[model samples]
Target chain A: MKEIALHMLDIAENSLDAGATKVELLLELTTGGMLEFSILDNGKGMDDETLKMTSDPFFTSRTTRRVGMGIPLLRQHAELAGGGLKTRSEKGKGTELKAVFVAGHPDIQPLGDIEGCWMMLAAMHNDVNIELRCSTPKGDFEISSELARQELEVEHLNESALRTELKRLIRNNLAAIGFTDGKIDKTILNS
Target chain B: MEKIRSLADLKKIRDENNKGVELRKKGEDADKLVQVKVAMATCGIASGAKETMEFLADSLEKRGVEAVVTQTGCMGYCYAEPTIEVTLPGRDPIVFGNVNVKKADEIIEKYIKGGELVDGIIPVNYETIDSKE
Candidate 1:
């Protein structure tokens, strides 16, 4: 699980470097007892040969770097957790990354603070469109940038204040939806 | 154990608990709630969404914002990572990206609390035909 999220961080970084303008994130916990994580992006997707080679530990597209282990790490973690990772991409359309974790697996960690995940994205990529959604047995939750910009009254909403407020909102929403058993102690991050 | 049959039963249990003291009853309308969305899309994570998300959740809890933080699949743009969206009651949701730990702190300090826009502003370029303007 640790490596799964870490792989997520890595692939997403690749997309960012590709000059993507929007990214979509989805986590679906199906009634069939499957936990799935998929990231889709409009950045320059990989070619067919590269896609096939990404899983190989020794294969990497980086010309300057000798070793690229992100994809291999993802494969290792997913398989260790009794899950698997799949990637599909086109040169222009985009790429899709999916990983599935079996329910009740001891290795699969609970999806951590996802709301905070988006906040982190906002802090890093301030100029891109981002949409995130999660669906579970309980219900569904969604967040979008275009939606927030339209609801405000200020002529120009302050980005810094918006970030803080978004964090607060995500925490509350997660609690409301039972994303976590209880509120995460806020003191940990700031201190 | 017998299943909980109604809202009243849930409330009764809440009333009996010490952990949730003075807590508002569930099943009530979420009229005044705040909703925060984290873009865990590939682009977002590559830009350090993981650390940023952790920071925000920890920070928000410290602030007692009564909010929810979660990871989302993606929104299509790959350049701006670690993206996030904020939604307050009766308001539109806001999205931001290109985040790091320091940016997360600034976000918590300025955007979340003060309702302000910060440095990272992703320019939306993709468009669909006959859209709502």
Candidate 2:
């Protein structure tokens, strides 16, 4: 939860737990220093009550433990960093989570280990497909697991060599888009 | 972003792929390979489990160890975040706690490769469904 990217990973995991077959993650940094992070999932959408209750740290439908802190913590982080979070869902449809933060806010956390996040998502969920798109003023990049699998001729994304190739592609592309060295300000927003 | 046609080509970009997405499928037989399960729940991640898992996968691959690395939910040990269970073929699984990158490397070298138990072994206080009893 220290990094906004960690929040992104946590929110995406929630989608996977909800039985989502397809998940889309979008990260955009605007010229005005606003970083928008969004995840769209085709899982079993929450009902009105569940949607309302998700903002509360103590309210979790999971029986494994009593508390679920992903959503609440993300909300807290976003708000504290001079931004906010919004969620929309409908029963039997899907859910979308969007959070925005100020890129240069002193309290804003670093974008922790996004490559690790994407790799975990791809490797852990072979059946589920994920599409990640990151955009900045410098450039934009998109990676789709389905496309990578097709091109690499691998049955699963977790194949050692293929996974390595996919990770390389993502990192190279992100670097091209100026997301290098984990510093988003000088590379993307300020530049 | 070139196409990988051979193993050498794959090796050329291995470090760039440090995420190590070598996830194992459920119900797959672990009889012939070392089985590693990384705890990736909220607590585990907050404590840097992702980096440890990545290191395990990369180091094992580099050392030519045949292993299946996968992620699992909480093992009810939040106090010991970033835990891992290593099960050699035909042996009882050993749970290691607080496994950072260094500890993971040591586990791979001393215990996994040398067959000598290392530090960080967590005693089993509760029985799981697959426990041998």
Candidate 3:
């Protein structure tokens, strides 16, 4: 993927396909020049064998195709960025995928359209209670679909205008936390 | 760039938008509206499917087309990335391949609004998980 946000999104889709009703994504950027996300989903998880083979690009749980590259690509990206991916799951339980990356590394991908990422997740899957929790060294912020729905008094979250509003909302919150695109401004965090 | 840390701020923005709540409420009768599904798998995103999805939603909303545009997994058409499925009311879903922003708009205008078929359709020959019955 060209961006970390896309990778998160791709992985989150797997969670949705696994019958996840609630997905929580936590993105944290620390002063140590590390960025990571913990995507936790309440869905049908995998057995030990399936989880082990997830790093192999050819292994997939879906019968749609013979190849599954989402997890493998994430692992490749994480390793290239001087970090790695860790997944823990159990059959009939849920799954938690944590990927860490050296944000300042040259191979590290840009965080493309973080707001757009959240917007797509919320708008596309209205039945799913998706939440984005962003934590920086300075402070923390969260964007929740349920709360936004209640505040807006709108039933569906897929409104195009509402997506525009959501993008602006996410962008402003990230800016307030000293994050521009994906990288956080260390100077601002210090102040 | 105003800080939008609270949900009330979001409501303010929504209320300020030109056609916000009423139009959203109009979509409550989902079965009566046009349905759009964008394929957003790994290959699709790499081929700019996200942009197509966003554009379709925006264009549909601007044209005031009562459509529910949602994202779906790969339609097993990775060779033709960025595919989409359009389902008019009480109609079977037709899959279109290689859908960039331009193609998505054309689909919206021609197939969706005008009820005309385009050239990028990949005939749905494969069976789905739910089709095994």
Best by lDDT: 3
DockQ comparisons of all candidates to the true complex: 0.04, 0.20, 0.42
What would you estimate as the lDDT of candidate 3? 0.82
Question: Order the candidates by DockQ, highest first — what do you get?
Answer: 3, 2, 1
Worst 10 residues of 1 chain B by lDDT: B1-10
Q: lDDT for every model?
A: 0.61, 0.77, 0.82
lDDT of 1 by residue, A1-191 (tens): 24343554566666666677888877776666666888888998879998898788677554422355667766666676689999999998788888887745677655665655565554455466666676666556676544443343222222344555665665555554445532222232123
TM-score of chain B of 3: 0.80
Off by over 4 Å in 3: A182-191, B1-4, B14-20, B23-31, B90-92, B125-133
Regions of candidate 2 where Cα sits further than 4 Å from its true position: A159-161, B1-28, B126-133
Clashing pairs in 3: none
Q: Write the per-residue lDDT of candidate 1 for residues B56-115, one digit (tens) a residue.
A: 766776687666665665554445667777776777776777777887778777877777
Model 3 agreement with the true structure over B1-133: per-residue lDDT tens digits: 2334676687687677646355445456888899888989887887888899889988998997888887888777888889998999998889998999989888988999999999998887666544554
Error at A99, model 2, angstroms? 0.9
Per-residue alpha-carbon lDDT of candidate 2 for residues B66-123, written as tens digits (9 for 90 to 100): 8888888767666787999999888899999999999999999998888799988989
Q: What CA RMSD would you report for each candidate?
A: 14.2, 5.4, 3.3
Per-residue lDDT tens digits for candidate 3, residues A90-172, read 78889999999886778888777888988888877768888898877767788887777777776667777678877977887
Query: Candidate 1 lDDT (Cα, whole model)?
Result: 0.61
